[model samples]
Target: MTITIDGLSIKKKEDFYANIKTELNVPEYFGNNLDALYDILTEHPDRLQIKFLHYDRMCAQLGVPFCQKLLKVLQDADILTIINQH
Candidate 1:
C-alpha cells in the first residue's frame, strides 16, 4: 500500500518521526531515530509506496541533511519509491 505523508505540515523533527512511527506501524521497540527508520523501511515485508507531498517545504523545515538521509534510506530499501511532489 502507498502511504502519503504531508511533509509541508511537518515542522518539527519530533513530529515527523512520530508520524512515521504511527504511519508505518513501527514496533514499540523501534528507535525514534533516522537509523531506526532506515532499518524499518529496509526490512519491511510489504511493498511500500512512500509519497512526500510538498517536499520542498519539508526540506526547508527539516533541512537538507535530514531529507538526504531519508532519500538514502528509501534508495537502500529498494522496495519503496519516493514520489516527492514539489
Candidate 2:
C-alpha cells in the first residue's frame, strides 16, 4: 500500500516521526528516531511506497538538516519514497 505523509501538518521532528509511525502502522517498540526509521524501512517485510505530500513545507517546518537526514534515510533504505511537492 502507498502511505502518504502530509508534510504541511508536520511542524517539528517529533511530528514528522509521529505522522510516519501512525500512518505506517509502525510497531510500538519502534524507537521513533531517524536511526529507527532507517532500520524499520530497511527491515520491514512489507514493500512500502512512501509519498511525501507538500514536501517543501516539511523542509521549511523541520529545517534543512532534519529534512536532509530524513531524505537520506529514505534514500538509503531499500524502499521507494516519493517527494510530492504539490
Candidate 3:
C-alpha cells in the first residue's frame, strides 16, 4: 500500500502523527509518538510505500531537528519510503 503525506498539511507534531495514524489505519491504542511510529512501521506485516510531499516545507514547519529525528525513524523502518521536496 502507498500512503502520501502532504507536508503543507502538517502544522505541528500532532498533525504528522495524526496523518500517519489515519493513513496507516493503526489501532486506536496506537501511541502518538516517534517510538510508536517506528514500532508500527517496522512491525507492519504488509509492504508499504510512504511518500512525503514537500519535505522541505515539512522540515520548516516541524523544525529541522525534529524532522531529522522523524526522518531517522522513517529511514530505519523496513518499509519503502519516498521523500519529495516539490
Q: Give each prediction's root-mean-square deviation over alpha carbons.
A: 1.5, 1.2, 1.1
Between candidates 2 and 3, the one scoring higher on TM-score is 3
Candidate 1 per-residue lDDT, tens place, 1-86, comes to 88888887789788788888888888989887878987898775788888888888888899989888888877787746665666
Model 1 ranges with Cα > 4 A deviation: none
What value does the lDDT take at residue 6 in candidate 3? 97
Better of 1 and 3 by lDDT: 3
* lDDT, residue 45, candidate 1: 75
* Clash count, one per candidate: 0, 0, 0
Write one digit per residue (lDDT tens) for candidate 2, span 1-86: 78898888989888988888888778988896889999888787688888999999989998999888887888888668888897
Give the worst 10-residue stretch by lDDT in candidate 2.
Answer: 39-48
RMSD of 1: 1.5
lDDT of 2 at 18: 85
lDDT of candidate 3 over 58-83, digit per residue (tens): 99999999988887887788667799
RMSD of 2: 1.2
Q: What is the TM-score of each candidate against the true structure?
A: 0.87, 0.89, 0.91
Q: In model 1, what lDDT does residue 62 have?
A: 90
Clashing pairs in 3: none
